[model samples]
Target: MTRVHDMGGRFGDGAVVPEADGIPQLGDWQARALALTLAAGALGQWNIDVSRHARERLSPADYGRFSYFEKWIAALADLLVETGVLTEEDLSGQEGDAPHPLADRVLKAEAVAAVLARGGPSERPSNVASRFEVGQAVRTLRPAANRLVDGGHTRLPAYAAGARGRIVRKHGSHVLPDSNAHRLGEAPEPLYAVAFPASELWADPEAPGDEVVLDLWQSYLEPA
Candidate 1:
């Protein structure tokens, strides 16, 4: 029998232990289950709280249903306030037509567009090979299908699978690593693109003769 120590409800290899009564205690698996349930509940509450905040400060037209997975909502709202789209006074108070107080500011269309234009920090790749160049022939690299469940990682979608293309452009010096691999802390490698026939991307495509440009990284392509 393993001696189980209670570390004041914290569970880890070296958690602090609290004095336990003789009652049989739950194991690590049980504790994890409970934690996961609580975390889910907290995430739900967070969405509700943020949504309510949005409705108050934002104009009626600007308010809409928000996604729980949008962690950057607060930051966006803050930017809105900073840009004068909404104000602290607008968010203040919890009465009148609005039930929820505006927790933050609302973003104007121009402000939103500006922010959208500035893409996030570049995630670079680890290993890469400069196998192709502009005006050079190249082919898509068909890798094994990913088995893991998708969430935040990036992978080549099925739509572009087995498609042939040409190197039409190079997006100067970027760390184009596998999105999924990058999420797991892998470095981003250089990336490139090969233009595919529109017919390749879509069967019975209207632009069958036209070339569809793809911004593929180095790892996603090989010499044709």
Candidate 2:
């Protein structure tokens, strides 16, 4: 699971460059990529987290070279094939069976803004109490030496794995991506804003005094 995507704090990638170019706008392909991802979601085959994880699973070469929306389109294709909606051959120029779930309505461009503004909410009721609280010190659990997490779908980033941090705030119970990505279940767990000192994650952090905040779930943390 630990791969290039989690190599943010490591070498090779230089200082975080601010967007110095002019105002950005979606190009033709990027716009279509966004629409396709939304259309596939309307089919009810996979959740948002699953789509994101799929993008992360893209081959390192493609994942590194593809533009942002390209990654989304790639993930969309992966999911469509994964859910039996399409096949590799279908993607490879073959005629594919139509998905008729939302046959009557279409996600028109006119309504794209409204639809995206009303984001998919994942909050769920939890009977279980949180084991940690705001201001609590905790450590992210690392997989055993011989065992890497089976995939990159987990909420715990590889850079932050095994490091200690403090819970700055609790965002209440929400669907855990670790389970949601696998379609195992909602697996709602307490979410927190964990703030780690920059030096903890990198040998020579760009900004030594800054803190790297990550939205971590309960399952990823334990007593420091």
Candidate 3:
């Protein structure tokens, strides 16, 4: 399902602005939000996919209104509560007498650099062969009949639905976000770089010669 956050190929929003060079764009609180998110995620209660889904689940009005980091902080709080790490009272600033539930798992200040350096890797070993080969033509799955309903988190962009493309490269196998976001098993699948002409995706393409390449999974494609 298409949510407000999926802004790909949409018109009239505004021009993209590049961040100023060497200048910090975020405030201290924004930095804290990022740190808190990473720290909470380190506890193993949820994965990156789950956190992304939490942000997407925000109400449309709130999603559109809040600034970027604001959304992150809000989503983080909700996830903490939902996972039983924090209570509603904790969020409301009522200090508790009991010890923190995840105190042992707290990301330590001394190990911050090591944790950041050893980034999370999603690619997993797969014994199954890839379904499509380079130069093979394929098409993305069309959107469901009910477009407004939530269909969980997905990496497929709404604009790319039903679009025709060709496999430009293979990325081996990786965790499928559709299942991972819902706490489902990480069903690894062959990922490919599929290139689609601009004309195929847009009705009135300003630059028809250009192409858009998306890293798509095997399940998202079929013989064209």
The TM-score measured for candidate 2 stands at 0.85
Q: What is the TM-score of each predicted model, taking all chains together?
A: 0.41, 0.85, 0.93
Residue 9 of model 1 has an lDDT of 22
Shift in Å, residue 69, candidate 2: 1.7
lDDT of 2 by residue, 55-131 (tens): 87899999899988888888888898999777788889987567655555666678678878988998788865798
Question: lDDT per prediction?
Answer: 0.48, 0.79, 0.86
lDDT of 3 by residue, 72-161 (tens): 999999999999988899889995789876789888999889999988888999766788999999999888212222577888888999
lDDT of 1 by residue, 1-224 (tens): 10111111222446557876797665665554444433332322223222233333343233334322221344344534554544666657432454333333333445545544653455444455566778887777554223232321224454665677788776644533333332333345656666778777675677657876767766666677
Residue 105 accuracy (lDDT) in model 1: 32
List the candidate 3 regions with Cα displacement exceeding 4 Å. 144-150
- Which parts of model 1 have CA positions greater than 4 angstroms off? 1-127, 143-152, 177-182
Each candidate: RMSD: 20.8, 3.0, 2.3
lDDT value for model 3: 0.86
